[model samples]
Target: MNQDLFDNVRRLVTTAAAGLAARRGEGLAEVLERLAQQDIGPGAFREPEPRSLPVLRHLPQCVGEAMVLDPRLASAIASVEDALQWQQSASYTDDLLGAGFSENYGWAEIIGPRGFFPGDDVLLGLLMLGPERHYRDHYHPAPELYWPLTAGSFWSRDGGPFVEQPQGAIIWHPSMALHATITRATPLLALWCWTRDTATPAQLA
Candidate 1:
């Protein structure tokens, strides 16, 4: 692992986690720690040939609104190159799965020095969960934030009924809030954050 890179990501995760804690505490602390340790940046991130997936939805509401509230947040996203990379082989059932991610899920570590809005160590970014035929219920150990850049996706949490989140829907899940999603008609795309406890990834119960 690159110590320099780790330091950068750690700083970012810590800042972002702190920010997320203001709105949501405890749940995100771990995610922040985990992200701080990764090296998923330009070095490991690959640039692939141009290709397009069949289904994808655009994010609405938040991007512009966030920019209006905090112009710097919008600008921060530009620094992380891998944030937009088409990950790869998200789903495998002949076609894509609803929550399975059509391509490999991508995370751009938008929290550290090179990222947007310096001074903030919060871990946040744009994410794309390619289409899956079906998305099973899974929950994370950290507080999570979701601002779907795409539309027409359903979100549900532990025993809770599913809710259709259109673009710009601010969805929050406290730690261990069994959540599951499904995409229909088209592919689903959204922004996601591990907030804190960066080491923890969601698991299907």
Candidate 2:
């Protein structure tokens, strides 16, 4: 494990949490509380082998775009990019999504069962979707929060219409609520967190 990489991830989480301080919402409150309880120090985590996915090919571009919106958060992400364990959902398939969906989507956990730090019931991570992709409706038991680092992304929740969310905007999804995401010409790089009920995985609608 690269001590510097681990520290960078820790800083990323810390920086993100700090930026959310002024946001008001029940979901955000719970996420902050859970994040507060996490110990991200050296002794609190086990190093997982670093990995990458096809979607990451666009990460540098996304991060660069993100810097224009939130330099602090974007730089935090860039600092730890090389050490992330990028992965995709085993249940997701090209047939279920789209022909190129497999190559366009992936996630990396910063805190959770599969993450560097084992968070009991909380999950913190990054989710990336390449250009012009639709991650159709999906639902999960846990409440979720997403802070998109880059722009030009649309999100839909609870069978609602898709709304364009700006860079650094926070999107929350309550437990079991249907949600989906779409990306246009620009790819997406977002920080996400699941406050509780982390046992169940997301199921597509």
Candidate 3:
């Protein structure tokens, strides 16, 4: 394990968490408070096998936009992009995401059971969706918070119609609440966290 790399990723996670903690919105304060109680010591982290998906091809462009919104967080992620292990949810297969959508969606766990830092029941990561893609409705036991770094993305919760959200927007999904995402024209990049009840994987609605 690269100690320096681990330290850098840890810094990025803390910086991003602090940034989210500063936000004023529904569910933000509660999630931030829970995050504050976690132990993020180096001992809690272990390097995992690195992986990537085709969607990552758009990462640089999305990160470019993210840099404008939050340079510290964006730069930190860019610095570790090459070393990060990007993966996708097993529940979302090509059949569920539509014909070619599977190729356009991917996520990387920065802090979780299988991530750089083994989270104490908390999960922090990045998610990306390519242009004109639909993630479809899905839900899990863990409550989720998403911080979209780029624009042109739409969000829907509990089977509601999708609504456009601009860069730096914050969206939260309560436990098992059906949620979905859509992107048009431009790719989508966002930071996500699952705070508590992390054992269950997401199920398609």
Q: Candidate 2: TM-score? A: 0.95
lDDT of 1 by residue, 55-166 (tens): 3232233344345433444433333332333333223343433333444344343443323322223455555454443566767676787755556778887668878876
RMSD of 2: 1.3
lDDT score of residue 104 within candidate 2: 98
Score every model by TM-score: 0.51, 0.95, 0.96
As for candidate 2, its clashing pairs are none
Q: Give the clash count for model 1.
A: 37
- Give the distance in Å from residue 202's predicted Cα in candidate 3 to where it truly belongs: 0.6
Local distance difference test, each candidate: 0.50, 0.90, 0.87
lDDT tens digits, residue span 48-116, model 2: 788999999999999899889768888998898887889899989999999999999999999987788
What local lDDT score does residue 96 receive in model 1, on the 0 to 100 scale?
A: 36
Off by over 4 Å in 2: 24-26
